[model samples]
Target: MHIELSRNSSVKLYLQIAKTLADRIQSGLLPQGTKLPSVRHLSSLLSVSPVTVSKAYAELESIHLVVCTQGKGCYVAEPSVSLHREEALDLSWQMSLIDYLPRAQLWRNFNHSRQVPYSFHIAAVQPELLPTREIINDTRRLSSEDPDAMAVYGTFEGDVELREVCAVHLSERGIRTEAEHLLVTSGAQQGIDLVARTFVGPGDVVYMEAPTYTGAIDVFTSRGAKVVMIPMDEQGMRMDILTRLRDTHPPKLIYTIPTFHNPTGITLTTVRRMQLLDLAQSYHCLIVEDDPFSDLYYKTKPPLPIKAHDLSGHVIYIKSFSKTVAPGCRIACVVATGSVLDRLVAAKSTTDLGSPLLTQKALLPFIRHRLDNHLVSLRDQMQDRLTTALHTLQRFAPAEVTWQAPEGGLNIWIKLPPAVDIAELGRLADREGISFLPGGVCYAGGMESNHIRISFSYTAKDTLEAGLRKLCRLLGELLDRSVIMERRPIL
Candidate 1:
């Protein structure tokens, strides 16, 4: 086998060697059970040390890619048929169906390529702004001083100090919850999963906003709950639709992002908030209020969370430090009252013993002191980016496209002409080294083909400009093709 080495490559030499050999094997260049050349012989051929070859072979053997008989040399292992292929493939298809089925019928007539990266991803938090150095220092300090804390299993409700800190922080937003009322989760994603597991079950009807957070939709659908989407306008979820659904369906849970909703960055007005609470109370439905991006409001102070207005024990408020602090830290808090908190705690205990104690401790000081200052800085940065993004879009984008300037969230929702296929545009952008999430992924029934959400949080200013240019170019090509196909003369 001929092997080449790059001295400047970031991957370890042995790993590179192993991967090259593995690829060759997978491609059938090396037949199954074929004996590999001796390490010393291979080392001589490649001009690498014997130890490097040995380590590579050892790794292959450990992974069952290769095997060595006690007295014989190393040989490629016989290809093992996956025992779980049928089950695994079935599960994968099932999950895909859960995601795509609701909207599959609508998509069937569309022939657009699904391979593209839709140029706008509205759901992701800005990882570049995360306080990495502070978290690392705090983690090191906590591990050095309190090794025992790291070793033991955390309490079922999660770290007490973290919960207390969350309580104090959330109290400012009008949620009067004690530490016991809060449960620390891996992140808000897990919080949603736990809430679904605790409250919803097979065939349970759950109410969510149209053009809602896609992640929440997946969680609820995966749990076998029937989702009912209430339409949303500029002021947020239409209270009338929610009320009608609540009265007719009698949903088990109402999931909504009242402050700066996901796809459309609309905030729920105070009157609408009260109306939702009233409907939930009258219907006896549990409300799962997800407010992950409420902290980054650009224009004005956001209203207090819906939970703050919950005089009745209907709202289960879930928020995350991931958006404002760090994504990898995976720290989120869920505040619920009475029996709801109790059941969620029990559900959480089953998922993992608890969330990482070190992460919880590292975040305590940051939440107490650094978070407020961080939000102010983040708000300023986001405002500047949002302004720049809107100007660029207005200048370069076609006149047919329109979007809403969100008050404080990381992304803006753009409405493209109906004929412009976003999935096809996304595939074209992917070839140019740009990635974006399609609007179809954000809707419950796969609707939103005419819309896409653009995020200014992750992409830098220069990259954003370049990406937008490329995106517009792709959109123009798609429109031309669409128009040509529509007007084609038939024989």
Candidate 2:
């Protein structure tokens, strides 16, 4: 009954435990109907929290390897029953037969059900925050003036006028690029996917910020690229470690969320932005700069993007309008030069022909005329919300917990005591109609289980304080439980 768990491994603790037990069961070492250790007993034996053991057992049950009774311990399922269950699902065989899917650890956990009244999980701008009237008027005008233009197919590269607008948009961000160099995408997500598809290949080396956007992790891994995570500090992704890792594993690309980073909400300093571009150029690799929150700044604007300083075309810049303008439009653009831009256009053509012409046209007027004023108002509102969230957290959060107040971005990253089990906290929070993003999914491989990300956006203003208070209470309760567990003598 010896089970080993490695804290340093990229795979999660629960998943590792479940996989080991599953292997044992499949190999006939753990026979069918064999009663497994109780959750508490196994937790003590493995030096882990009961919640971790519970999650492992639950995973085992999900794949039909084990079963648990209300009061009894988990037991391995019968071979025949397991076989029948596997046979019931057609795609189950495909998983073993072909290596087609990526290890999407993030989506498996944070599915964004939105079933809860107090959801701090979603990272998009709420409808009330968007310029709905302005966009509607623009759409109406486009329909009235040129009905046939909206109906016809746009070039796979994107609408020329929309590209022109995006070029102007990039110029404001300090990136100098023309319409010909821009590739309009369905969204920033699609832009990331296109980059992955074009440049990444099996076993190729890709580097990223340790806790980056979840979608980037999924996309690169799906392309069979080995993702090496570089840790970050207050300033942003650690440059020294990246320098060290580059000697042994020179990357094909470095994916970054430089400004107002996702999950953590930390911005890379101007010095590091230049350093990053330099490193990418030295390594002869490309940098995919994802800038989703640069415009939503609370204080002074963030430094110019990494792409802005790229004199050698080492950076591919992606800007999304989903958060700032209209989410339903799903509009974003990629700025690249030479062959890289050509390959991205080729990838986009294969993916969806092109992003919808109507949406692009509908958004063009807004981006041209109203985007600046809209962002100013949006930033003001977001800053107010951030203030309220921070005050609530400071008042109710446990003394042991620590978090850095982000200057801008939708999320607030909170670090709890290591002893507090995140699995149990999530279960409790979900039961209480609360949802937040677990920190595990943000990493490329290794995980930090004691951290959680809560977005200040997309929650109703009235319930925001209550949700923060409830979450803080839960953290306190878990810490107390961990103390009690530590004091108990081993039987």
Candidate 3:
């Protein structure tokens, strides 16, 4: 129902109104048979005359985009196109096909084809920051040493040597685990999907932080699990609210990104980490701790993952190297204990037999020898980019615009005034060769449109600064126009 109209435009008012409604209808934003607001209601909403609204509705009816009922309001019309003889096969039966998996908004946003000159939507370290040559050398060594072994299928649980190396790597973060307790996954996303497949089911309750990782949301929802979002503050997911929600809808699992959380870039405090584990243990629910950005901290290390304190085998820790290292390699591991670990292995076997052994072996040498220095270099470079982003935002952004300075993580979440039209701002940004993540797509329940997430680690510092400046200028223009519209006299 949120619509933007320009009174100063050359387009006719009624035609503009019809076009907006037509766009929404065609895009499935306004589904078929949806009842539109009454002419009076829409007129009041748009601050236009009822006659203008009527003309818009009539325009839509003439084009067969909407069907008017005798007493009821206008409704979106179903497709009435006549099929040509060459393509006359009736495929309408496919319309009734089951949609076990609803739309994944994040995937749609990320996979968009429009190439922007300055993109901040990707949440990964810059390619230049990754250890490329060393990885290539490692792959070459592995292929040369054992081409036959690399070509063969690995054990369902994954390469023992890679898992062993990962175990040692995790020990530095205070998570005590052996190679046998880990299950190698294609990536952190695969780890999440495996866990959801192994446990979550239709109508099962899954708790998540609002504005959490979009991939996690899609994974859980695909399993038909009821994803309930817990609101977050600077400290992370509000524990008090979580406790209350658990009493009402006991969850099968709780998903969290404790360190350098995606979208928001907030880390959960140590106390909360322990508190979350305790609640999970008490409630007899498992916690899926996704830790992709934990190693990318700007200064001090983040609190040890919830798995560190998980004495009762309640935490399933997923560690990803895709973002920090070469994303093309796509190597990550899932750490769980007992039955949970067994189930994940079983599920992974059915998923892909095992992750590509070649990639795992290719990444092994880098992890054993060069990982620490590589991470340190990445942290420093990301920190510099973060500083540049903050400086540019301060210099160009309006006073009304605000954001929290995250200590770590690739993204900075910015809040715009509620009155400003984010869709319009996005359109303008796209035209200016800029792109960012709109906040509404991050949520599971309450759709928030006044916030946006931009990554500092993707673009070069100078390009990042320039893109952010352009974004801020476009936002300022939208804000100014919104004020003018609000003060415009009622027609």
Candidate 4:
């Protein structure tokens, strides 16, 4: 019987109180013919005027939602004869509509197989490099010394100091952005969601890099937009196809991860970057550049982000501190050049007032004290693991199993022989002690059956070797079974 009322809401106070009680009755929490509290008692409990409670009860009785007798206190009605079956049917239909509105696809089939022990998730954030001790100390300091900052709701555009620090970091990467152009969000996922909600809508054409980040695909597709998949090669998205497509079907937005792309682990070439910018400028399509792994370069020098070449104010750049700093901290920023920033701000304001201010404040110390040095250390450590993983994979894998060594990034894209089925192989690997992402999840139309993405980021040297060996063994078994099945006479 807890009724929390908001004084600021547009709904009348009495109606709000009535609705709360009606909801309890409808939900069966208040059984049929249950006695409700007296007006004075409810008023005192809710800290509201008795007149308001009296009006609410009168309205409920008038609607036959509750019955009031001469002597007995107001009791929940056992559905009066006036209530129609069609009304209940209509309510059920409305509830079904809300339930099936295609919200965030938070649950997936892969999560159900957690019963298998030794499950290695290739798409997880690397935990070994997370700044745990530093973040814990900063959290303690912020909670104790700056209690007011944590207690109050943050600004719609997030903390100004954090935006200033993010602006400086972007400047170093050749993206000329200011604090005003930046908007902090819960994570890069929320940043992408805000961008999608603000710009594209139903029937809008949104161009996505083929085999792009599955999470982005889910967000855009769930919004009822027509997702047009642009093909990608080793250097990244095929610009020629995109240019032709842009000429024919103008897209509302072009989403890409130009630097150290996920799954493929390929950086976009300078020529393609310039072409993309030109296409975006010529056609009126917005470009969303998701650059989360740009700072984790191992062998080659990091290339400038797509934002650096954007002479026009069409590209929206997004970056996350989750991968570089700590995932639990969940801090990300989006920089849009023109009116896109305003729309994103409005959408974000409605979603949440702002990201956690204390988390933003804690990150200031990392940017000031030891961000560069931490990246350097991480690079060195990852380089060692990458080299070891490459050598071990090469030694254990069969000749038919081919992969390219990415100059930088956390994972490797492996192309198995045509006859092998990676989806089935993933299940078989799950039964064993190893796991990897099937390539079908990355593609748009459920293609690419013989490909897999293997991450060597959080995996230790011994585990990396052991996992590769186990995977190769499974591949061999699959190939042998395929050969045997092919050789057998057809029934």
Candidate 5:
């Protein structure tokens, strides 16, 4: 039996063989109760270890795809029952979404990818890092003291007290805003959607850094806006290209993640931050400054958000606590001075009435009291993981592959050799039981690129060490194979 195996995958050899054999059984290529090859015979035929073949057979047995007799060899099993019927099901939506559906599908695929076990693609904080005890305390205290806050519908803009807390928080970060200007959003993604819906429309040009957040891209494109990609460097979004695009496109909004940028983990220089604000003002374009990872900085502290220097209220600043404080809190505050704030509030009304009152109320005390202490410890733990990941890469990665060391932020951006295919690498990684955010998913157009984002924030330190080594080994093997293939004579 010739069983094809993925040499570059992170998945173990036995599981791959098991899945392949199972597929053959399902397809009726292998009849029910058909005698299968002995472990020694299969191993010899496939050029794999007998132990691997035995494990594969064992896996098939566990899945009930095969049954082993006490004295005889393994045999294919009868088809088992399933909960649902297998049929072609497709939704015929009212709207013509031919152009838009691909984006939705890509977003859905990326989201589904996160469910894989031991996923390194997840950028959110680990569950162990969350302040569960503190939240429980806050919930109990709030339920006793402010039952009305929990039961009754809260204000549309958000609780005045929480808004006040957010305002003070924003002020500390150099974003000068009052409770009146602050609007509580469900999350940073919703905030981006609100801004996109309120301000953007069909054919309205939106400028963003090439490898920006996927949520921002979805918001812009789903609204039928033209998203123009701006290039980036170590300092952050390229101001030269931005100015030229501003002149060419006359963009309605410039969406940016200026601090601890996603995927790349680059921070905008203070000078560039100031310059970006100036460009936003001069071009009369709104800057959606999504600042989530700023607080997670492990190296040099980043400069203030563009909203901090918003002399004309052109910048909409959103600071999300979900990534750092709590994953399900879904609480982020938006700072917009006048019309932006009012429109966002109106948009909030349209998009699910408002964020749950209980979530807001429960988080208020935690934010007020426990956040600073939690962050101190959280930052230290993340720093250790970051150090471990880097050390692992140094020890295992191919000399040809280079990763730019990020000062802060959850991800390390790896620049692959130009000839390498990211999709192939991604499949290999997934097969090997590791998942990662391919750099293309970070861009506006979902164009495959030579960069890969490895996050150290989501997994355990031990998991990170092993996962990084596996990833590096996969890259090394792939790079070597590509070199060999390049030199081999083609028929």
Candidate 6:
């Protein structure tokens, strides 16, 4: 039998040797008739004295686990084994306590993937715009040059070379950061989870805009934190209300999607951005900025990121390239310093060790090559798509419905009449072969129900107007009725 032992274990060497062999016997790995080695042979194999091997054999015999013949070797005995399991358990009750992201009917019908044949529910680059051939070439090239890219485990913080490159890229965007302060994450989703798990606790307050990313709401709430909703204005988070909240209860963290805010597509103004930084520092609250759309801007240049003005590391900035860069790459980075950075890295370690090194290395060269030329084409095409979608909405939408043309982002948030039934609207829209994100899921308290988020990034150019017309028709029908009925009973 092949055996390995730990000298540092508290158990005696003979007992350790006996347990290992006994386990193999009970497991049926060592068959009933199988012969163990001679005492001297086993002693030499285990690098122990013959007396230890004899004692181990004697222990197995005393337990009736093995048969020792006078001249021959010891053999495994037939084992009567029993494994206990709870076939009918209250697992649901236990899971209800910690389960986040349960599959609901809304998402079951419309997911991030292309499960639905016709969809506007997800935001991603069109297939034509994605650098498929280039990505393949880069992956093949990396595999040939550095086999370790796939063979070895990446550093806990992720690839050093990739981090250096990311540092330079962030510097160009007005965020003066170094490689040491950044931890590469699977995507912005994990970045949010890491910050939430590392810093937030049960009953701690986490302030976020009323209508923000649904994933953030789910993460914080599932962890038992009290997620307080801050109101949002045209510019961004309402600073006046934020200041009042600060005076009463200082939040553990303030989560924001500052530039091209999710669902709403509203970018925070430069003045608001500065004010947010000051408030965060004064309230002793850390800002978790989830930024995935700043690079996807259209006409006007978006204001500097809230992290750009952070002089004292009050902000943990998360930027994802999964939507803008190749979707399959699943790449993003987190920028923070001090204890926040240290804890986030530790949290990330428990999440997946680190994002796959092969993905990081494979995309590194492609990113370097695409910075100028490929990005320009990408931006131009997305801008055209957004323009087409906006025109379509304007042409068909009724006078009462309104939407803000975002500075740069993939989504256009449509505001329905407050009385309109959003759930019924979603069901009808699904029947029409179009899917979009209902705004109710975006709220922490899940009470808001007057908005829907549609993406212009994934649908084809030719199908854009037709899909939008269908949505407008449905909305027009829903709004025409004096009282649109809600799917659930009014409380």
Our tally of clashes for model 5 stands at 4
lDDT digits (tens) for residues 1-491 of candidate 5: 44555565577888867865764564344656566877887788778899999999998899787998877888777532320121133322321222232244235435633555456777777788889778878888888988897678878898888898888877887877789988888888889989988999867889889888876776786776768888899899899988876776797998989888887888889898888888878878898989888888787677877787787888998889988887677899888887778888998898887788888988888787778788888889888989999999998988878988877788888888986778788889888888887776676543558888878988888988988888888888888889999999989
The 0-to-1 C-alpha lDDT of every candidate, in the order given, reads 0.77, 0.85, 0.85, 0.78, 0.79, 0.80
Q: Which lDDT tens digits does candidate 3 get at residues 1-491? A: 64556586577899878866774564355557666888987899889999999999999999888998778878788633332321467553443343343535555667635567788888878788788888888778878989975668999998999999999999888999999999999999999999999999877899999888877887886676778899999999999999898888898999999998888999999999989998998989999999989888887988888999988899999999999997988899999999989999999988999999899989998899989998888889999999999999999998899999998989999998987777778788888999888887787633556889998888888899889899989988888888899899998
Candidate 1 lDDT by residue in tens digits, 1-491: 55545555576888767865664454344546566888887888778899999999988888777987766878888734442454455432231121211122112222223332333453454557778898889888888999976788888798898889889899887888889889999999899989988888766899888877777876776565767888888888888777666656788999999888876889999888988888888788888999888888887888888899887789999999887888778899999888888899999988997898888888898898899888889889888878888888888888888888889888788899988877577667768866665666566533445787777777776777778877777788888898899899997
Distance from true position, residue 140, model 2, in Å? 3.0
Candidate order by decreasing lDDT: 3, 2, 6, 5, 4, 1
Ranking 1 against 6 by lDDT, winner? 6
Query: Candidate 3, which segments miss by more than 4 Å at Cα?
Result: 1-93, 112-114
Q: Estimate, for each residue in 300-344, the C-alpha lDDT of model 6 and write its tens digit.
A: 678888888898999999988788677778889999999889988
For candidate 4, give the lDDT.
0.78
Which residue pairs collide, candidate 6?
none
Clashing pairs counted in every model: 5, 2, 0, 0, 4, 0
The superposed Cα distance between candidate 4 and the true structure at residue 65, in angstroms, equals: 45
* Whole-structure CA lDDT of model 6: 0.80
Which candidate ranks first by lDDT, i.e. highest?
A: 3
Q: How far in Å is the alpha carbon of 95 misplaced in model 6?
A: 7.6
Cα lDDT tens digits, model 4, 228-250, are: 89888888899888878876678
Model 2 clashing residue pairs (backbone): 10-445, 10-446
Which candidate has the top score in TM-score?
A: 3
